[model samples]
Target: MINTYPLLRPLLFSMDPEAAHDFSFAQLDRLERCGLLSRFIDKPLIKPVHVCGIAFRNPVGLAAGLDKDGKHIDALATLGFGFLEIGTVTPKAQSGNPKPRMFRLPEANALINRMGFNNDGVDACVERVRRSRFYQEGGVIGLNIGKNASTTLEDANQDYVMCMKAVYPVASYITANISSPNTKNLRDLQGETLLRQLLSALHQARIALSDQYGVRKPLFLKIAPDLQANDFKFIADLLLEFEIDAVIATNTTISRVDVATLPHGNEAGGLSGSPVLNSSNQAIHHLFQSLQNRVPIIGVGGIQSGNDVRQKIDAGASLVQLYTGLIYKGPQLIRDCVRVFN
Candidate 1:
């Protein structure tokens, strides 16, 4: 299937990342409608495992920023993910940064996008989720929440809280995004002091909601790849202290040290692709090693095959995920990893 997908790559790769994303989703939607998505796809290994107190059919998941608005949840589930995370949705809608915000470094198998949390907001995402039948059929889905693009870092708490409240009813889990480099001052929330404050607020919200609604759901943190050892240590400590349920070990890297020779080396935004593999793994290892498996880590960077999935699990990721890998390797990548897991 990977080989077959490569046939389409020439055409898909010819377009911008954002355009290609739409094209792929549209194709997936068509496949699902025709009941032929699974024909090209292999049967997923349905071995279920418990993580974050939720059951997943497999450990491989679709990372956020791919299906940012929960638009094609059913189509995504058909691709064989144990779970699909959507959004970075905020309290209100915004147009994001600008056109040409997404760049492709095909030679490096990477993408650099300054798409500042663009989405139709939390309500719209929820409507899409509510309308999605995939969740009714045992698909695990995560909601990645964020502050509105117009909001300030100091006031990000309100935005996150609102999204949490709005999406909690439908999401299997929640990921608080504090690490998108494109949003101005957003990463600042990752600071020791700010992180503590934000996590505390979100935790309180989680507890209050759980008690009030009598429903218990996982709340994880989506951190940045740009942190130092000190930052990692502090974050791990904070997670333990705050009882943060899980951690998405990275978002993307703002640094471009590895792709220096590439023509688009100095491009802005976070770099996610083969170049991020080492840094992300190191961060995952640092967290996994320091945390000592106290919390589960979802490692998602530069993964394109079964071996990459194995490496992430070996390093300490309880579950693995991808975005760039799916683009470069195609849909067969999911079945390949599930084959390994089985």
Candidate 2:
């Protein structure tokens, strides 16, 4: 099939970035309902890999933040991702930062969004996931949970615990998102002392939830890319100490060095897409070395092509995910990455 996104990009680009996002998904949902989505894209290649005790059909996954509420799991699944991670969801619903929270840097193939953990909340997301064909058919679904914007840093652990317990039964894996730059001081959770406390609480909660559900779900941590050089080893030690299953190496970066001169380059939010590729890859390499293969790394950031996928794997990522790349390259990017793994 001829890739049609290039032709369609102009229309979407003309609209507001956030509006374009909603419109794109709305259209995708329509096409999926009509069962015509596959007519425009090739099926993703099957190249199975077992990571963190889950058998993935391929290494390419739709990263968190794309479908924040898990509302389009079935539609996205049809496009053929090995996994789908939805949320950054919190204990309560939020409107996110505000209008114009998301911005596009077309020149840099990047985006800057301070869309604070905006979602339909955990309950709504859980219900949506429950109704999805993907979940019912045993597809890999990771629930990435975060604290409510209103939740205080001191009370953050409770929010995370609540979300974990609620999603534990449904989540193929659960990620504690402590790295979003958009959230005020959320990254403080990454501090050594605070991180230890949070991980310990989560470890205990996971133990109980594991016994309660009669199955143990892997717990993953997502960290920011803008960390000091020595942080990786310390974080790796904690993961080993707490028996955490995996780490999503690097979230959106707070650094704007790469896009400072571009339009919307100075936006006050986490920078993602091509600008983040190098930093995130460096984070993965650091984590990989510190982890020594004991813990798996899920590489995500600025993955726009099959070669980018190879770079992540070479850097020691057992798996990789796509978000911004999808916006620029469209669904064809999924198949492209999958073929690289094959």
Q: Pick the candidate with the highest lDDT.
A: 2
lDDT of 1 by residue, 1-342 (tens): 434898999999888778988998998999998999878776676868898789999888999999889999988888788899998899999889988788888888988888999999899999999888897775789999999878887888999999999998999999999999989999999999999999999989999989977998899999988899878889999999888889997888998888777877777898998888888888898999789989999998888788877877788898888898898888888878776664
What TM-score against the true fold does each predicted structure earn? 0.97, 0.98
Clashing pairs in 1: none
TM-score of 1: 0.97
RMSD value for candidate 1:
1.3
**Worst lDDT 10-window in candidate 1:** 333-342
Error of 1 at 46 (Å): 2.0
What local lDDT score does residue 146 receive in model 1, on the 0 to 100 scale?
92
On TM-score, the leading prediction is: 2
Local distance difference test, per candidate? Answer: 0.88, 0.92
Model 1 gets an lDDT of 0.88
| Model 2 CA RMSD to the hidden true structure, in angstroms | 0.9
